[model samples]
Target: MEVNRFESINEGTILLIDKPYGWTSFDVVGKLRSLIKKYTGDKSTKIGHAGTLDPLATGLLVICTGKATKRVVDLTADSKEYIAKIKLGETTPSFDLETKIDATYPFDHVNRELVETVLKTFTGSQMQEPPAFSAKYVNGKRAYEYARKGVDPKLEPVPIEIQSIELVGFDLPSLVIKILCSKGTYIRALARDIGKALNTGAHLVELRRTRSGVFSIEQALSIAEVEKKLSNMCNQS
Candidate 1:
């Protein structure tokens, strides 16, 4: 039985990784694939990430190798939770700090009470448009391309649900929030709409994925740590 288990070790492996901000999902997969190949000397150990993470956002990234790659879709469809900060009184093209600032205005009139009311309104199912600078495809091209050419694509609004959104902190234009949402929810659009409702305009200031489906950031391992474990295992042999 021990020998059988050892023989099946390469069949599948699920690795949870704490993805650093500014690294694309593909970048993580590529890095891990290289690491796995080097460590196990298995050139065909297929590696893939379960979901995409924006460059500005960081947190749990689920990586599956070998037969585990088949389970990525189920993992991605699971609900996700995020800790995010939305800045009032500013609007950006990308809906986050990465894009060009479109407008800015006074937000001193905004208050906690008003924010709570707006949060309540964001609940339930509603149509949400993804950011133009997102990976969403449009006419065989990325939405960002249309945006870059100053041509606004007639993007269709998709349905999404906000299970819960609560304000955790507020400091003038900066407001920290916790969101539990269904799959395909765009926090950037939520911030934009929240700003609109508050009459101050808003953009995402910071964002982090704390949980996704059954996986949490707490269980995520760093690339360095994974490599260290691999090194130790080889040394033992």
Candidate 2:
């Protein structure tokens, strides 16, 4: 590929990158900004991304460069799909594997059939309360900040819709499930709520965003691959 052709790549173009584990959305944007500057040597082109994925989770991260930053508002509202593993018999303060396990219960009472039946309850529109260890604002401060301390704040319930929930697999206390939901849906909350419904406790053990609207993992470029592409451009010049 010729370096000059990128000049025609234009602004407002969308790029999908498979975000690596343990990297924040801001981290991705920073690396991308550096890569873009290294290749184009043009600092005026803007770069941005739609939506935020927790560092523990990995998958399609939609990136917009140049004029595409203007469309982030609309893109952030697009539906997202994820394949996640929920670990039963344990409850975490953050509602995911990232937090400390506050309690654990016997899971002999939960089976595949029971898990399937519980899925029925999560489907459809419902009001869900965000986790205490979340980015959601609380009294003008981030909820996670208050949660990290000893204070448990009053987190309000927000509307969310589960378009579909499928039981992919189950291995005793661990369950693999796929979810398609509207914006603002929290899988962490779902895991906790499902645990509550089953007389057990649950937390997200693993998570991967398989799809985000038209963007899919299939269309995503790895950070290394993207860096390579930029490098090739510099060498050619």
Candidate 3:
């Protein structure tokens, strides 16, 4: 694959990297910042990421450097696609495995047909309440900050658009779904809502961002690959 982006990395360019699981969005930015500085011999290079992916999530991450950092806002506003694994019959505090299970429910009644119907209810424009364990601000502090201390902040329901939802696989309490949604949609929250609609509890087990705007995971390189490119750049410099 020809990646012209890395060629102008020092000058300012967009870099698409596949973010690995267990790595925070900031961690990726920091690593890349160091790599670009070390390889291009430009410590002053500016770097930023368009959207933030949870540490538990893995997939495409759009990173920008130098003057390209200015485009982060526009990039973050783009719609995204994700493949998420949601588990029914159990609810967690963070709406994902990041926290302990808060409750459980009977999922004996949930079926593929019911799930397909429920997913349609979530399609199109709707107001979604974000997970309490989220980065959303409340009273000048992060909502997760309050959630960490066992306080539930007043998180507002934001308007979001779910372009499409496809039930890729479903067996018993576990489900695999493909979602195309607008910028503000939270898969965790969606999972919780789906549980409610089905009279059960649910939480996110795994999530992977597959696409953002025109960039797809297929076009992204891993951190190691990026490092190799940087090393080559250093040799050239």
> Would you estimate the TM-scores of all the predictions?
0.94, 0.94, 0.97
Give me the runs in candidate 2 sitting further than 4 Å from their true place: 1-10
Q: What is candidate 3's CA lDDT for residue 12? A: 86
The CA lDDT of each predicted structure is 0.82, 0.86, 0.91
Clashes of each: 0, 1, 0
Candidate 3 lDDT score relative to the true structure: 0.91
**C-alpha RMSD in Å of predicted model 3 compared with the true structure:** 1.5
Best by TM-score: 3
> Which lDDT tens digits does candidate 2 get at residues 1-237?
111124432354777889999999889989988878778786777878888898889998988877777878888898999999999999999999778899998889898898899899898999999999889998899999999996897899999999999999889788999999998988899999999999998999899999988778887888998888778877887
Best by lDDT: 3
